[model samples]
Target: MINASGVLRTPRQTLFWRVTNCAGAQDSARIFRVEKYFSPYTPIKSRKSMNKGEFVESLADRLDVSRAQADRALSAVLDIVAEQLAKGEKIAFTGFGSFEVSKRAARTGRNPQTGATIEIAASSVPKFTAGATLKAAVNGK
Candidate 1:
């Protein structure tokens, strides 16, 4: 079973068998398999949490450019995004998503490893909300 937090509690074999038998099932199983094998349960530095190499490669193919060029373009785009967000401007890409600045209120949290209380400072952060097209595509709609 999957939790509200998007964690799968079932064994791999169980998930595999169950997903494989479903007719025309979306490839969530493949995604889970890739995530399981490729990435560890570590904190991601950015909000998007995408794998850089894979993102660059895919962009290269889509944009018909070299990987290096794709990487540069992606970096440039991200830099622009960050700049706009820093200025409290909202950015919207027609088919992809919108990025807006959000204010996170200061809150108290616990350090899981040490069991110590910690204060999380209030801050403005960029948040992304996927467009309907992107969401539908991800959901195989």
Candidate 2:
């Protein structure tokens, strides 16, 4: 519950924490109860995902190369992977992972809207299998 000064009401009603810049506001400091710092009272933010462009910029910085060069390198790697997968060949990076073509057999499926049966055609798709090193890194080992 919220109290008079817009602070959350703790069980003790005497507990309060000085929070600065909560919810990305303009550094507005507020008194929060110890428990209110976790959820609906204030939203939690996770790490942001990196897109291709951002990855290219980061790569350029790390490799001490021009952005164009980094983009071209990244593009080349992707193109090679696609070419290899097109040939039904596997791509492996020892400490990273492997990519291979997975064959999915045709099957019959139901149409939820019409409740009619349909046949799904067989297809080959690229799949990734993470290696132990990558798995450990992801799991923070």
Q: Candidate 2: give its CA RMSD in angstroms.
A: 10.7
Candidate 2 lDDT over 60-91, as tens digits, reads: 98999999999999999999999999999999
User: Weakest 10 consecutive residues, lDDT, candidate 2?
Assistant: 38-47
lDDT for model 2, on a 0 to 1 scale?
Answer: 0.79
> In candidate 2, which residue ranges exceed 4 Å CA deviation?
1-45
Candidate number of the best TM-score: 2
Q: What lDDT tens digits, residue by residue, belong to model 1 across residues 23-98?
A: 4656675432223321344333333545889899999989999999999999999899999999999999998999
Tell me the TM-score of each prediction against the true structure: 0.55, 0.67
- Model 1 clash number: 0
Q: Where's the lowest-lDDT run of ten residues in candidate 1?
A: 11-20
State how far residue 89 of model 2 sits from its true place (Å): 0.4
Residue 69 accuracy (lDDT) in model 2: 100
